[model samples]
Structures are given as C-alpha cells and as structure tokens.
Target: MKRRKFLKNSSLSTAGIFSASLLASCETDKKPQVVNKMIKPIVIATWDVLNATNKAWQVLNNAGTALDAVEQGVMIEEADINNQSVGKGGRPDRDGNVTLDACIMDKDSNCGAVLYLKNIVHPISVARKVMEETPHVMLAGKGAELFAYQKGFKKENLLTEKSKAEWLEWKKTSKYQPVINIENHDTIGMLAIDSKGDIAGACTTSGMAYKIGGRVGDSPIIGAGLFVDNEVGGATATGVGEEVVRTVGSFLIVELMRQGKTPQEACEEGVKRIISKNNEKLDFQIGFIAINKKGETGGYCIQPGFTYRVYSEQGHINKTASSYISS
Candidate 1:
C-alpha cells in the first residue's frame, strides 16, 4: 500500500512539473516578436531641384509626416526665384502670365490639385488644403485662387524680374519651339516615405514655358505626374507633361511594382510605354522616379542628362542617373 501511494505521489509530482514546464513554454512562445527597429526613411525628388532633398530630409528626420515632408521639400523649389521650371520664378506663358499647377497625394489615396492657378505663391500648399478641406479632387483658375485666398494664402506675383525679362526676350522672335530641359522642364516632383513607412508625393510647376494661356499640364493631374500607394510605392514625373499624361506614367510605375517589378524596372517600363504609343519618337525629355515601400528607388528618362536626388539614413544627398537615357 505504501508503495502504491509513493507511486501515485511521484506521478502527480512529475505531471505537475511537466504542466509547469508546458505553461512556461507557451508563455514564452506568446511573447511578441521583436521587429527590426533600424528601418530608415527615404526621400526622392526629380532633378536636383536645388536643396529640396535637404528640406525634405529635415522633415523626415524630425518625425514629421511624409505628406508634410514632400510639400515642404518641393516648396523650396517653388519659391526659388532661380528655378525657372517651378514655383514663383517659373517661366511664364505666352501671354506673360506665370500660372501655377500643383498636386499632392497621400497613402490613403486622398489627393488634391490646382491648375492654372495664378497669383498664389505656393500652389502646393493650396493643393494640400484642397485635399484636406474640400470634397473635390481639383480646383482651377479663378476658383482655385479664391480658395487660396479663403485659406489665408496671400496672393503674390509669381513672375520674377529675370523671368519677365526672359519672356520679353522670347516675345522678340515669338518662337514657340522649346528645347528639352531648357524651356519645357515643367515640374519638381517629390516622393517620400516616412519613418513609419507611409508614403506621400507632391508635384508642382509653372507649366510649360510659353504655353498658351489657360493650358494645364500633367503636373496638377493625379496619376499622371504623381501617384502614391502606401501598399506599393509612389512615383512622380518631370519633362514633357503631355506624354506623361497620356501614359499615366506615375500610376503605371506603382502598378508595375504591384506586379513584383523592381522600382527601376517599373520606371523603365513606364518610359517604354510612351515610346510604344507615341506616333513618333519623342524629341523632348520625359522622366519618372519611383520609390517602393521597401525604400528602393529608380528613375528613367526619354533623353540623357536626367538625374534624381535621394536622401536616407544610408546617405544624404545621393544623386543617381536614370537607368535608360535616350540617345
């Protein structure tokens, strides 16, 4: 009988030990998995565009949102009186009016844009307000200006003395022919991914130099000049806006990425699409830059001399050539 009792007691003790060990193991397994915390943020912009990357990097480093970073970054170029392609100092239309076009997009698919908006100094900011405060996707011309005024944006003449002088010179001959990257570099498109992995993009321009009055380009049109999808990536365009608009270049890049192509491949495909569809080979430049959710970046252009700037923890102010540059 004592032996039987001893056997039973030992069995209970062993079972209890096993149960305790099992419980401890289960608790250990249930502990949350630690994710790598060293993922860096990314910023990319079309062309060098002055110190725009620095401005964007500052925002991302300070934990600001991606939307804020892109807007702040491109605004530097917009306000730069020397950059004839964008913002206040941008080249004017044939009518000598410096009209602006801009668009902003966020990961949530919210987007806003303004086209042929005159007198406003920062059309990008106006675009942001349109995205956030209004139900419409776009505002144009006088209506856009009125919205800017209501939003407390001051009206300022966008044309600088230098830009005006250039316009007057162009009027001497009234030559409408524009060289690639000289008179037709139409936008400063910026894309950024914040520390939290959210993506956003912005594209702003003064429209094509010496374009007819009231002409709008792809810069203010979502999916053409800019597109952002947090689940995939973001893309933006520069150069001839008409080709980009027809191909929906930026949107095509993101969708290509969704199909598992790398950023470079997607961008090249975008450029190729334009080549295939156009009746004649493009004589002007058209370029695209894209960044995936993984922070990979790539760009491609129809003509040579196209470059883009990137900022990240790995390095700041890195400039890279496009994968394909037309001969």
Candidate 2:
C-alpha cells in the first residue's frame, strides 16, 4: 500500500511538472503575439518624390498626419525650379496667357477641394481651408482669389522669365496671333497613404501653357483629376489637360474600386474608357496612380511613357517617370 501511494504521488508530481512546462511555453509564445498594439508612425509624400522621400520620412517620424505630409510634399513639387510643366513656369497653351489651378482631398473626412482658381500661388492650402473652414466644397476664379486674399494669401508674379520667353518666342513665330497650337504640356499630382493608413492627394499646374486667360483644366476639378477615399485609398493624375478634364479620370478610378477592381485594374479601366470613346481625338497623354486600402497600387498612362511617383507604408518614396511616346 505504501508502494502504491508512492507511485501515485510520483505520477501526480510528473503531471504537475508537465502542466507547468506547458503553461510556461504558452506564456513565452504570447509575448511575441501581443497583437502588435504599438502605434505606427504617420506617412506622407508628394509626387516630386525624388529626395522628397526624405521629407516624407521626416514628417512621418515627427508624427504629422498623412494628409499634412502629402500636401506639403506636393507644395514642394509646385515650387520646384525645373518642373517646367507644373506651377509658376508651366508651358502655355496655344495662347500666350497663363492661368493656374490646384485641388486636394482627404479620404479620411470625406471633405476637401479647390477649383478653377487663378493668381493663387498655393491652391492646395486654400483647398484644405475650404474643406476645413467653409461650408462650400469648391471656390473658383475671382471669387477664389478674393477668398484667398481675404484669408491673407499673398499673390506673386506667377509668370517667370522663362515662361515669358517661351510665350514671346511662340508669339514671334505666330506673329502674335495668339493661335500657336503646341501640345504636350504636363502637370504635377501626388497621392499618398501613410503608416497610419490614412489617404490624401493633391494636383497642381500652371494652366496649360498659353491657355486662354481663366481657362481651367482637370487639375482643379476634385473628382476629375484628384480623389481620396480612405475606405479604398486615393488617386491623382496629370497630362493631356483637356482629356483629363473631360473624362473625370480620378473619380472614375475610385468608382472602379467600388466595382471590385484592384487599383491598377481601375486605372487601366479608366484609361480604356478614355481610349475607347469614338467621339474625341485627345491631344495629350494622361497618366495616373492609385493605392487601395490593401496597399495594392497601380498606375497607367494613355501615352507610352506615362509614369508617376509613389510613397507608402511598406516602400520608400520613389519617382516612376513615364510618358506616352506612342498612342
């Protein structure tokens, strides 16, 4: 009987030891699997995208929101010296006049835009204000400038010596008829999602080089050239001013996402819609990029070499330059 009691006690002791070991193993595994509840840093960027990557890193590291980073980054592109086709020194259209416009949107709040504005150096800032302060979604032309002026925005000489020289040369070539038809003007657009997973976008341009005074392209059209929806992500486009204006490419991309397409597929569908139309002979190339909530991103251009930049949570910011050298 004593022997039996000893065997039972030993067995119980062994089982208890095994149970403790199992519990210790579970505790060890649980430490690593704590659901990674740590907050991620913010992310932001603009399409200027080359060294702008560092700027995005700076903003994210500092805890700036994704929208703040994107707008700031695009502002950098607008202010770039050699960007020639966007803001300040942009190429003119057939006319010698210069106009400017910009737009920005945040998917987080479902509120944002600036449209058909002129003489305003920083349309995106105005757009953010309109979204945040005023009840309206868009402000345009003189009214836009008036609002900007009232808000203490200082206007500068939008026309630069280089742009003027180009205008004069074209005028000389056309005997100042103001009917020189040159194509291939470009613009700037940026779309981004930060580590925090919020989305934002901006588009800016000096009006089509020599476009008629007060002419506005898709650049300032909210859904036309730029759009952001946190549920899906965001998108922005540039190139072929008129075609982009007419097709509403940016909103179309979001709608494509609504229809269950990937960001790249949505971009392709938007481009296809522009191409398959039998009605219009589009003069310039249009290019766009999109990022969905899943972090799947895609871009397309109707022109052969169309490309844009991208910055996201998983990848560092980089420019993917492209154009439509062909059809």
Poorest 10 consecutive residues of model 1 by lDDT?
174-183
lDDT of each candidate versus the true structure: 0.88, 0.67
For candidate 2, give the lDDT of residue 183: 40
- Report the lDDT tens digits of candidate 1 across residue range 1-327: 699999999999999999999999998889686543555688999887649989999999999999999999998988888888888888889888999999999989999999999998899999999999999999999999999999999989888999999889988886665433444684799999998888999999998888888888889999999999989999999888888899898999999999999999999999989988875476677889999988899988877778899998866665655645445
Candidate 2 positional error at 296, Å: 1.8
Model 2 Cα RMSD, Å? Answer: 12.9
Best by lDDT: 1
lDDT of 2 at 224: 81
> Which predicted model would earn the best TM-score?
1
Model 2 Cα lDDT, one tens digit per residue, 1-327: 699999999999999999999999988878553322333433323244555445655666676766777677766656664666665555655554445677777765545565556566677788778778889888877787788888888886666788778777876666443332324345666666566666677777775566556567777787888888877767777766567667788888988897799877888777777766624454556677787766677777765655455544456645453432333
TM-score of each: 0.86, 0.76
